[model samples]
Target: MKKYCAYVLLGLAVISNAALAKEAPLVSIPTHDAFFNAIKAHCGKAFQGKVSKDNVGNTFGNAKLVMHVRKCTDSEIQIPFHVGDDASRTWILAKTGAGLMLKHDHRNEDGSFHSSTMYGGHTVDEGFPQVQSFPADVYSKALFIESGIAASTDNVWQMMIYPSRFSYRLIRPAREVQVDFDLENPIATPSAPWGYE
Candidate 1:
């Protein structure tokens, strides 16, 4: 009789747990697909940008900043970031199945890879459709440490796309840089990025 009672109680507990699990609500979070589509919507265009904020210093002071959505594929988008006459930087956004990845491809005037190139991060969460943030990933941290810029190990890059504006931002412990582009006004597409031409 005692064994029967214990078995009944265990069955009841299992049923109650299953009931509770079924009653749990579903959560909906913004996805990388949405964010990627948001930026992909502006492909094949060029826009002018300005240094909106730079607490570290005016590294791009007064330079004519431009961003061109140069190439787009099903799984990747490459945007060349032009600062004045220098066109050695490209922002590559690619879908990693699990999430999105952001990589900075830097090249020299002769189309050679820079010492600190191809360093970026991957999204670790369901960021919003208009914005996605990527914290420094393992590769980026190691690259920073090896390149003697260990302070960049904590870098977090963010990209925001809206109807009229798009922003690229970099955040670290003591550094913050942002550039906002005017999407409302499309500019002539600049020359291809280094090694991309």
Candidate 2:
């Protein structure tokens, strides 16, 4: 019967489509896992850094910078980015089932969270082992709007981990900032970042 043959053909098409779907890989698995592992290799180590690029002003042009890969867990890494005597910033990288999350932890001298703290982005697609990009997430957008820094809502932050250098970068339409650290020659570890001690 022609009707029976049509049903059989439809079933075959459906089965083939399901097979194709199974063959396609999810966007955020293997690549992000490698990146996470590469960064984890430097756990508990602190590295000194310097500003390599900044178009917003001279905020970090002449400051002594440091980044401590201080605390590490199976799912998250806490790195304190210190500029001169200001230990008010910490960068958090977290691995989630969906993708990676990047957060900024800002604190006061007395270890209190600032009004603009914990604002950051999340990785939406596959990224290479040496580089990962994060676009502003919901929380960051909301915080920026509330704090009157709404321009940051479209910010894209990047991190680069290489054999001898690690860099943190920020990119937006009209602003860009980058900081590079010498991984092969780390200086003496500084005091614990604010809010950690």
Backbone Cα, N, C clashes tallied per candidate = 0, 0
Clashes of 1: 0
* Cα lDDT listed for each candidate: 0.90, 0.87
Candidate 1, residues 1-197, lDDT tens digits: the string is 99999999999999999998773332334477777877888899999999888997888978899999989986799999999999999999998767889999999889999998999998888988889999999998999999898999999999999999999999988899999999999999998987887
**Which numbered prediction scores highest in TM-score against the true structure?**
1
lDDT of 2 by residue, 1-197 (tens): 99999999999999999998774343458878788777888987888887788897786757788999888887889899988888899999998668899999999878989988998898978888889999999989998999898999989999999999999999999899998989998777778877776
lDDT of 2 at 173: 92
Model 2's alpha-carbon lDDT is 0.87
The residue pairs in collision within model 2 are none
Taking all chains together, each candidate's TM-score versus the true structure is 0.83, 0.83
Error of 1 at 8 (Å): 52
lDDT of 2 at 50: 79
**Candidate 1 lDDT for residue 143:** 96
